[model samples]
Target: MEIGLNHYLVLSTLLFAIGLIGVMRRKNLLLLFFATEILLNSVNIAFAAISHYYGDLTGQLFVFFVIAIAASEVAVGLGLLIVWHKRHGNIDLDHMSTMRG
Candidate 1:
């Protein structure tokens, strides 16, 4: 059987759910960033699938923008993560409560 839009949608939904769970359960900054990327990728997959089904380029174009944004986000986020890790020696959410202004 050929894969259809519904199959793509279901897959995307599952991916997004897993990412959401990770974001909620993870305490590490790096893992949170990874989860966010997974969420973004799921959206990209849905967009591409819908665009293909509808014979339109808008969704695909949106996916491109999403990828660009995700890339920039990763760059900035990782840089911040490094700085935070260097200052505190740990990137755990619970440990962050001890930070002072």
Candidate 2:
């Protein structure tokens, strides 16, 4: 009747799986970024759960760093998405190759 590490792990695994599927199936650049964020959040959950289970702060610390990085990634990624959308008038992944150098 109580939550445990296994519960967190299962949830994390499910989230990661969903994110992976989204990344694979989504053709929009914004959707891909969303999937990546989901994947990052799943990892954060696992790290925090394991850290709590082991009575250690390292996992929690790592989670903080991950959050910071994820935030910055969202900023840069959204900026790029906006630029791409402006230039192309669309955000399809299939047409991204047109930006190649």
Best by TM-score: 1
Which segments of model 1 are wrong by more than 4 Å? none
| Candidate 2, position 89, lDDT | 93
RMSD (CA, Å), candidate 2 to true, equals 1.3
- What are the per-residue Cα lDDT tens digits for candidate 2 across 7-51? 999999999999999999999988899999999999999999999
TM-score of 1: 0.93
| Per-residue C-alpha lDDT of model 1 across residues 51-98, encoded as one tens digit per residue | 999999999999999999999999998898899888879889888776
In model 1, pairs of residues that clash are none
TM-score of each: 0.93, 0.92
* Worst ten in a row by lDDT for model 1: 92-101
Candidate 2: stretches off by over 4 Å: 99-101
